[model samples]
Target: MDDGQPLFRWSWVVSNWDNDSPNSIVNLLQAHIVMSAVPVIVGLLVSLPLGLLCVRWRWLYQPVSGLMNAVYALPSLALFMILLAVTGAEPVTVIIPLTFYAMAVLIPAVVDGLASVPEHVRQSAVAMGFTPLRRLVQVELPIAVPVVLAGMRVVAVSSISLVSVGALIGQGGLGNFFTDAYQRDFYTPAIAGIVLIVLLALVADGALVLLQRLLTPWMRARRSA
Candidate 1:
């Protein structure tokens, strides 16, 4: 403990809460939320079109998947340093790398979700005289919701946790706690950060589950039958 304080103290968290400073608990948490959320939203949006293309043209899947895998393999810290030079924006430095990471997860999720549709499901849509676009919107995608939500749950939790890594460059949000713990030799902030992060991940995952339920009511109906 720094200054003879205990290893973990709620007082440290309480005193720092929303103190209106850069390092305050509330500020770091809010920064953490934005830093985490923007990438997932952007990644999902980009993956939808890309995944649809990959599914539509079978040959495209290999090249696209390979590229995403390569991108995924790149170290997050290394990318942070590299992107730092390319832009003057501080948050972008973190957001850009995290966006790519989310895509690496979400693209495959989108593809797998689409692929999960049964062959009979497709035939039924066609038999109903559904156009390609209408079929995708009304028939195929609704059925694919569960699988896609599963992937989203994974991405959301991981993304929330990963935001802490951004602290190395000073954009880490709650991740700054780890660095602070190291520098000050105080464990309180670091412990609090971890607890808060887990809670945030749980909340995000639960929200996704609720969304999945709302989107796929028939899943329950099928289970009962």
Candidate 2:
């Protein structure tokens, strides 16, 4: 369906940047970064305690995991539509739903990470008279960082991708390009948006991997062994 239209024109992408509107590519990119980051941060905070509770009880995990799965399964578009009434089409509406999505992944990661701590380690901490709270914060969570960050890597990428869907309600960040391109029968914005989104995901994932290694230099040594 060429329709005598050039599929991609570099000038169009440049023009999108040059455009002074709030919907300019630069503005959307900034919004995209902020919108994608806030949810993951909030979700991680929320998951830590919930994950701890599940680990402590064991019985609660199945039900709590099920509930989170249900929340994750809700279509983002539909959730955005529903949230629009309460948040009124703001970035929060997108962040709120993505937070649940992040938790759906992070909670399980947290549980599994905590569980991965060798029984001997916990016993040694107890033998050292480390209080439960102190052991958890100083000993357990540090060891759990790699696993939890693994989950966070996934959440970050997924959140970045999902934020594009917010364009449906006008808060989609770079996602606006997709909608705008379709409406205007143009291609440059859509292509640029995709490339940028992918690059952002890669950068974010790489940063998390670096953070993991930095936080657990011993693990890196073990891997070399």
Candidate 3:
């Protein structure tokens, strides 16, 4: 009941959990999950092919990578605004920028992972009569899975945090909570929203880590050696 302790009180948040309309904590959390996840998935799909292309065409790597890096460096909000002009205020505007940012982080990791495959391994695959495409698919990509997954973990965490920013334009996940709290001069929702976002990021990172371990048991064995 103390007015000054609005944000710190666990009781108020618990009490408000089932409140009507858009302010429901469950609704916001669900929205946040969807907004955070979709962009990363789209980015991974696009980056995988683009990364492969960069690796295959050595000459294209520099320019392509430079472009991605530049895109990554641009502010997320700024990028969102630019996309707004063309894509309008829809979710696609947020998603496109997020996807490009994910690509920027992923492409270098993918390119490096693919390049790191031992020359001897590649030669051996060629000797065994594997075509370039077959060798890439059957051997190189398998070896690169760990590094690529590491990049994915990074992308996933970043995407989760950034999803909140979309709330600036009413497209955010838990970001709306922060905006609402600030507008209403109440901090309980803001506090809850941030906690959830961090937990979501940690959960996502942990899942990716587990996936990497499952996919590359050899790496685990090598590490334990």
Supply candidate 1's per-residue lDDT for 224: 98
- Cα TM-score of candidate 3: 0.92
In model 2, residue pairs whose N, Cα or C atoms come closer than 3 Å (at least 3 residues apart or on different chains), thus clashing, are 167-172
63-88, model 3: which lDDT tens digit per residue? 99999888889999998888888988
Candidate 2 vs candidate 3: which has greater lDDT? 2
In TM-score terms, candidate 1 sits at 0.95
Error of 2 at 96 (Å): 0.6
By lDDT rank, best first, the candidates go 2, 1, 3
Task: Report the poorest 10 consecutive residues by lDDT, candidate 2.
Answer: 10-19
What's the lDDT for candidate 1?
0.88
Q: What lDDT score goes with residue 143 in model 1?
A: 78
Deviation from native of the Cα of residue 131 in model 1, angstroms: 1.2
